[model samples]
Structures are given as C-alpha cells and as structure tokens.
Target: MEELTLTTPALLFSAISLIMLAYTNRFLAYAAVIRNLSEKYRERPQDSLIRQIDNLKLRLNLTRWMQIFGISSLLLCVLTMFLIYINQHVVAVWIFGTALILLILSLAFLIREIQISAQALQHHLSDMEESLKK
Candidate 1:
C-alpha cells in the first residue's frame, strides 16, 4: 500500500467527531426517557410501563456499546496517525484497518438501536389508534 499520510487519518476525525456527537445526543435522550419512565412507574406500576423500561434498558446498553466502539475508532485513528508519523507504515495500515472496522460496528449497533426504538414508538401509535377506535 501507499504511504499513510496524515491527511488520511485527519479525514476520519471529522466523521468520527460527528458520529460521537450523534451518539451522545441519543444517550442523553434515552436518559431523559428513563427518568420519566421511572417516575411514572413509581406513581403507578403497569405491565406496559415495565416492558417499556426493559426495552429502554436494552437500547441504553446498545448505545453504550456504540459509543465505546466509536471512541475506540477515534483513538485508533489518532494512534494510526502517530504510527505514520513515526514511519511505521506496516503497523499503521493494520491500525487504520481496525479503526475502520470498529466504525462499522458502531454504526451497526446504532442501526439496531434505532430499529428497536421504532418498534417502541409503533406500540404507542397502535395504542393511540385503538383508543380512537374505542
């Protein structure tokens, strides 16, 4: 492969930064929902509320893993740049490849979390439609 340039890893910096920001926003929103659910459950426990809380817990875990992989990717990119600076082309290539894979894994988890979240929303919509029918 050609020499690993600083620009190559630098390009990933922008993408990783934006991804981390999105993950953070998702985490914060989940936290808010969890807190709201907790209060509502405390006031009056319901099976549906319990299920929603369980679903949120799974989503929260997925988001956590997504953040972890994303951050790992960013760190690997920085490490790869350093390796390139030190003229370790072989190792730099491996590290850069690993970073790319981690980024893909992070996005995969993000997709899964979104799919689950959509299901939860659909449940709410279905309830509303049922009420309308009533």
Candidate 2:
C-alpha cells in the first residue's frame, strides 16, 4: 500500500480539475464576447457580423463538447486514482493517460478554431481599410 502512494491518482485529478475550470472560464468569456458582438452589430443583411455569428455558433457548440470531455476526464482521473490505490496499476495508468491525451486533443481543436477566427477578422478588417482608402 505504501508503494501505491507514489501512484496516487489524486494528483492527476486535481490537475485535471483545475485545467477544466480554466477552460470553462475561457469558454464562458468567449461566449460573452460573442453575445455582446451579436447584440451590438447584428445586421439582418449579409455583413461581417454574419461571419462572426457563424463563428460564435460553432464555438458555442465546441464549448459544449469541451464541457463533456472535461467532465469525462475528471471522472476517469478520480476512478483511476482509486483503482491505483487498490494496486490496479495497468488499467489505471492506461485509462488516466488516455483521458489526459483526449483532453489535450480537445484543447488543440479549440486553439485552431480560435486561430481561424482571428484570421477571418484580420482579412475582413484589411479589406475594409482598403475600401476606405479607395
């Protein structure tokens, strides 16, 4: 039992919980930004706001996925820790590692989505500046 202390799953669970909380907070802020923009610059006709709306909708959906994945990871970490405490080494490590990897992959997808949004906004702003100069 003493040897199993080194493999305590509580550490993983704690870290996972913190990471999930941070990610959730970030997504909430992002949603707030989108809501504000949608309310302020919402035009019926086609405009930059349309693209923003599309991006916001997609992001919100992705955020929901993040929540699901975060909770799954959290649960897996807690379960893995308990299993490890009972000396179930193989399955615990395998599952906890898998959950961590999945969580990382989910975050990667979000980063890419945000990058696309930034690029779109930059292109639109540049085009607008060009038109103004004309």
Candidate 3:
C-alpha cells in the first residue's frame, strides 16, 4: 500500500477551491431567483412574502459563508504553495497537490449552490403562479 504523500491538508485545499467556484455560481443563480422573487413580492406583498424573504436570507447566508470560506482557503493555498516553492523542494509536490485540491473544492461548493438555487427558483415560481391564479 502506498502512502498518500500528497497529504490530507493538500487534498482539503483543492476541495476548497473547487467548492468556492461552485458556490460563486450558486450565488449568481440565487441572485437571479431573488430578482424573480422580488418581482412576485412586489406584485402582492402579503404574508407569504415574509416566508420568501426568509428563504432568501437563508440562501444569502449560505452565499456569504461560501465566499468567506473560499477566499480564506484560496489565500492559504497560494501562500502555502509559494512557501513550498521557496523553501521545500522535497515537499513541493504535497503543497501544490494541496493547492490543487483546494481549487477543486472551491468549484464544488459553487456547483452545490447552483443546484440549490435552481430548485428554489423553480419551487418559488410554482408557488407564485399558484397564488396569482387564486
């Protein structure tokens, strides 16, 4: 059995990066949903509006966390990679590997965000239409 010289931290970093990109896309999708929802709320600001507003807040919170995590992970990955490049040729592979993992993680988060946002949009639109018909 071969040991993973790449290190756990490195894999984590790559995963973080992928997550960040994914989250970014998600946030963008959520923004679109917000726009649509806003229009619906404007048409008739009833009690249901509060629920949608809360839902939007939840999504925004997720977006904020994603951004915070993505930025922090990205900076750390870059710094670690640079340090490895300068000081540890032997461990350079592990550092860069970690960085790669972080990048991927960042993107993964973004993807997750997008899927959730799209679903929310679809669900909300259905509800909004149903309400309008009544």
Candidate 4:
C-alpha cells in the first residue's frame, strides 16, 4: 500500500466529531425517555413500559460503547498524525488502520442501536393497532 500521510487521518477528524455529536444527542434523548418512563412506571407499573425501559437500557449501553470506540478512533487518528510528523511512517499506517477498524466497530454499534429503537417503535405501533382493533 502507498504510504499513508497525515492528511489521510486528518480527514477523519470532521467525520468523527460529527459522529460523536450524534451519539451524544442519542444519549441525551434516551436519558429524557428513561426519566419519563421511570416516573410512569412508578405511577402505574406497566409491563410494556418496563420492557421498553429494559430495551432503552441496552441501547444506552450500546451508545456508551459507540462513543467510547469513536473517541478512541479520534484519539488514534491524532496519534497517527503525530507519528507521521515524527517521521514514523510505518507505525503511522498501522495506527491509522486500527483507527479505521475502531470507526467501523463504532458504526456497527450504532446500527445495533437503531435496530433496537426500531423494534421498540414497532412494539408501540402494535399496541396502537391492538387498541384500534377493539
């Protein structure tokens, strides 16, 4: 492979920043939902809300890891740039490659979170359908 340059890893900075921002937003929204659900659960204690809360808990965990990997990737990208600056081209390439892999893992977790969110929405829709059927 051609020698990697500092520019190559620098390119990821904006992308990773945007991704981290998105993940943070997701975390914030989930926090709001969890609080609302917790209050509702205390009031009525419905099974569906409990299950939804459980799903949200899992999603929150996934979001946390996604943020972790994404931040790690960002840090590695910076490290790779420093390596290149120090004339360590070979090590820089390896570190950049690892950063790319970490980014992919972060995206995978994002996809999983989306799937869980979709399932939760579907559950809500099904309940609406059942109510309408009656």
Taken over the whole model, the C-alpha lDDT of each candidate is 0.95, 0.73, 0.66, 0.96
Query: What TM-score would each prediction reach against the true structure?
Result: 0.97, 0.73, 0.56, 0.98
Q: For candidate 2, lDDT tens digit of each residue in 39-126?
A: 7775454576777777777877776776777778778777777777788888787877777876776677668767866776797899
Candidate 4 lDDT for residue 30: 97
> Candidate 1 lDDT, tens digit per residue, 1-134?
47789899889999999999999999999999999999999999999999999999999999999999999999999999999999998999999999999999999999999999999999999989999999
**TM-score, ranked from best to worst:** 4, 1, 2, 3
Candidate closest to the true structure, highest lDDT: 4
Model 2 lDDT, residue 91, Cα: 79
Candidates by lDDT, descending order: 4, 1, 2, 3
Off by over 4 Å in 4: none
Native-referenced Cα lDDT, model 3:
0.66
Q: What is the C-alpha RMSD of each candidate to the true structure, in Å?
A: 0.8, 3.4, 5.7, 0.7
Q: Among these predicted structures, which one has the highest TM-score? A: 4
- Which lDDT value does model 3 have at 118? 80
lDDT of 4 by residue, 31-60 (tens): 999999999999999889879989999999
Q: How much is the lDDT of residue 17 in candidate 1? A: 98
Error of 2 at 35 (Å): 2.6
